[model samples]
Structures are given as structure tokens and as C-alpha cells.
Target: MKETFVILARHGATEWNRISRYQGHLDAPLSEEGLEQSRALAGALAALPIKAVYTSPLSRARICAEMVAAQHGLAVTSLPGLIEICHGEWEGMLLSEVEVRYADLIRQWRTYPYTVRMPKGESLVEVEERSWAALEFMAAAHPGEISLAVTHDTPIRTILRRILNLDQAVFWQIKLDNTGINVLGCRQGRWRVIALNDTCHLGGWLKAGEQMAL
Candidate 1:
């Protein structure tokens, strides 16, 4: 089989993101800064031979996907499987709030993410299964070509965990910045991570002397 490359990118900043809130499956719109980031992302990826664009159905991801697709003159494809992990009851809560209320579960989620299921939500295992399937489908549909997927942080992290053969225990260790780009290459029926959490494109948009904490 021919090698196929897929670029997985996290959506830009949202209001929830700035407040450190868990967005989960909630459909939050991108903030003003997020729009700028999305525009910058489109410009950065404009030079690539991107043939297709796939994104989570959620507006945040869709918005970014549209911008990128516009640059390549391609239509955006929304995939439900690429949506962010459902936080269940914790969806709209601030991270600090979840830390205080569901301290134990949060610890386990931070430690053994693969083992714990969100209350009324989903397990990391479930997330990996669905998102990977979506990604695989994308890769299979576009052999010897490049495609881009705009999704959330958790899905990107989980997908990377699988590609890099990393233990699920360190899931949270992988930090994904808003508009971060990750590259995956598939050859011989196997996928390898070519790049991870690359945010170099955001350099011009970032404030001078300000650092990204993602």
C-alpha cells in the first residue's frame, strides 16, 4: 500500500478553553483569538498538498476545518467519530471544579485514563476505538495523498498514544496546544507519528514574550 499522510489538528481557543473548562461534547464557538488562530492555521497549511479536510461536527472544529479547506479549495467533511470525548456530567465544569468534586476520579483519569470511564460519559478505550476507526477510514480513503482532520485535544492525544505505542498511564502528559498540528504517516498497514503538538504556525499570532502553556 502507498503511504498516506494525515494531519491532525486541535481546534483553536474557545472561551471555555481560556477559562480552563472542560468542553467535552458541548458545541462551543471559537473565540475571537481562535478565529485568528484558525486563519493562521489555514495560511500555514495552504502550501501542503491537502486534498481533503475532515473535522469534528462541533462548531469549533468545523470552523477551523472550513478555514483550512477554503485555502485548499476543498469541501469540509464533518465526522462524528472525531468529536471530543464526552465529559458527561463534567462537561461544562471548570477543571479546578472537577478536581475538587471528583478528585479521586480525576486522579485516576490523570493516572490510568485507559481504565476509568467518565461518569455518564465514555472510557478512554472507547474513545480510542471510535476515533482511530475514523482516522483509519480517512487514511484508507485517500491513499498516497494528504488529508487534514481538525479535532479536539483528547482525541488527538488518544490517537497519538496509539501511534507512538505509549502507555495509557501518561495520557495527560501529552500537551496539545490550540491549533497544534500532528502528522501521521501510514505505510504497510501501520501508522507512525511524524510530528506531535507542533504549534510553530502560531508563532506570529502569539503575543511577544507570551508563552503557550498548552
Candidate 2:
């Protein structure tokens, strides 16, 4: 059977990302550095035989999706199911601030994320369900072809966790950098991960130490 290749990528960085703030459903634009990273990500995938491009409706993911789609002369199709997990009241707050304000929840989030839900937001189980359904739909729609989907950190991690059949507690262990690329192959609804968080495209930018915890 022919496999459908899906390139799952995390959107480029934002000021909130650099500051360790929760972005959730906020529509933050990419920083200058983020724009450069998106460009590099696009350049790296330019020669691939990509048939379509998809992205979260959020602007951050849209920026990267548009760049990569432009390279292939394709229009980006926004998928709400691929959006980031809503951090609800914690959307724009810093991690440190959240830690102080919601001490118990914050501690639970790091230690037992699967059991903790962000104040008014979502749970890991919720993200996994929607994101995995979205991925399944994408794979079914593009059989035997290659496609790309740009999304946020939580969606990537949750989807990868589900794909790899890993325990929910291991959620925080996945390290997906800004503009990180992941590849998966699917056939008849069976998925296999080919790569995870490949950031070699960013070159020297990886040394900038811009990555921070969510």
C-alpha cells in the first residue's frame, strides 16, 4: 500500500513564546525571529512534492502554513481541530505568574497533566481527541500523497503522544521547537511516525536558546 506522508510542524515563535507565556487561543503574530524561522522552514520543504497545506486557524500557524503553501502554489486550509489547546484564563499569563496564582493547578499540570485542566480551558484528553481526529481526516483525504499541517505546541505533543501510544503523563517530555518538523506516514488509517521535531532547518537559530517551557 502507498503511504500518505504528512509533515506536522509547529508554528514559528511569538513574543509570548519567548517570554514563557501561555498563548492558548490568542492570535499572536510571529516575531521577527519567528518570521525568519518560518522562511527557513518553507525553504527547507520547497523541493518536496507537497500536494496540499493545512494549518490551525490561529495566525501564528497560519503564517508558517502560508509561507510553505506559497512555495508549492497551494492555498492553506484552516482546520479548527488542529488549533492549540485553550489555556482559558491562563492565555496570556506567564508561567511564573500562573505558578503563583494557581499554585495547586500549576503543580498538578507539571506532575499530572493528564488529570489537570487549565482553569477554564481544556485537558490533555480533549486535545488528543480532536487533534487525532483532525489528523485522521487529513490522512484519509490525502491518500498516497504528501501534505503539511502547521499547528501549535500542545496539539503537536498531544497528537504525537496518541500516535506513539505513550502514557499521558509523558506529555511534557516531547520537545518540539519553533518551526520544528515532524513526519508521519499513514495507510488505511494506520499511522507511523517517521520523524519528530526535526529542527536542522533553523541552522544557527537553534543556538539562540529561545525555547522555553509552556
Candidate 3:
């Protein structure tokens, strides 16, 4: 096996996304726009020679992965590590409310996650470690095979940072939109980022910037 390429797909829009909820671990279905996003994403990936598929157990990610996997007659296996970070107390809080309640903590998270917690959530490192483990496991499980993983935003960012061994501040510099596809290829003990936060399929239909936050 020379290299293994994996496409990281952030699940399409969710109902909470429309209402601006935390949506960390709460399972919610995708909105109508999310469905359209999934369709477009599946169509965009239709040409790729995908061999296997993995998805977060969450409905939104699973749905998107299911549609894409259908194109190649593949079955999606839900990987627990691919699930979103467990936000604990902040699971369903609005970002604005978190800012008001955990003001200093939020600032510290934005600054450095060394001393921040979402009331009772997993630390940033916990998410970073587990998500990378998932990535490593996926690459190993399907060596030299083109695999696709459907998951959430923060986990994807954390995994990317791990692959690059980047500094903590690098987290803020990255952005992932709804139904966005990030392509990565692991080869010869190194990972290559082919694409990041790509949303060309919907023809700019994807919401960006603060709209990407949830």
C-alpha cells in the first residue's frame, strides 16, 4: 500500500444549526438545506474511486455518509471516535450564552485550551487525541484504499492539526462549513492535505464564517 486517501466530510446542516444551538452530542436530523448539501456532496464525490466508508453515529453525519456510500454500493460503519466532541454542559447552549456564562473560560479556550472546560466537557486534548486515533485506525484498517469519513467540525480540525503537529493557535485559523469535504492522503509515514474546507459543489451554497460556528 503506497498511500491511503481519506475524505473528511462535515455533516450537512442540522435543525439546531438553523436555530443556533450548541449541538455537540445531541443527535439531530439534518434540515432541508442539509439534505440538499448531502446530495450535492454525494454527487461531487461520485467520480472518486472510493472503496470504504466510515461515519459518525450521529444522524446528520450518518445520513450524508449513507448517501455517498450508496453511490459505490458500500456500507458505512459508524465509528464512535468519529463522533463529535462531548460538549458536556455546553451541549445545547448557544454560543452567545456560553460567552456570557463562561466568558473568561471561553476567552481562554480561544487563547489557549490549557485551562478551559465546557462546564464539564472533555478537554481539547482529549478530543484531539481520540479523533487522531480514529484517523490512524481508519488509515490502518483500509490501507491504500480510498475511504471517506463523515463527521463534525471541531473533530476534523483537531485531527488536521494533529497530522500537522501544529501549535494550539492554529485551531482558530481553520474553518469547516456544512457538508464541506476535506481531502487527505496518508503515505510513507506522512499525511498530505489535498484540500481543506472545500464547498464548491453547492456553488457557494454553503454558509461560511460565523455561520460555520455551532
**Index of the highest-TM-score prediction:** 2
Q: Rate the local accuracy (lDDT) of all candidates.
A: 0.87, 0.88, 0.85
Summarize candidate 3's per-residue lDDT along 73-116 as a digit string, tens digits.
99999998888877788778887887788788778877886356
TM-score per prediction, in order, is 0.93, 0.96, 0.93
Worst 10 residues of 3 by lDDT: 205-214
Q: Candidate 3 — which residues are off by over 4 angstroms? A: 205-209
lDDT by residue for model 2 (23-49), tens: 889898999988999999999999999
Better of 1 and 3 by lDDT: 1
| lDDT of the structure predicted as candidate 2 | 0.88
Regions of model 2 farther than 4 Å from truth: 204-213
Instruction: Supply candidate 1's per-residue lDDT for 199.
Output: 78
Query: 115 in model 2: Cα distance from truth in Å?
Result: 0.5
Tens digit per residue, CA lDDT, model 1, 1-214 = 6799999999988888887788888888999999998998999899999989999999999999999999989999989899998889898888888888999998887678788877899888888999999999999889999999999888898899888899878888877888988999999788998988777888833431221111
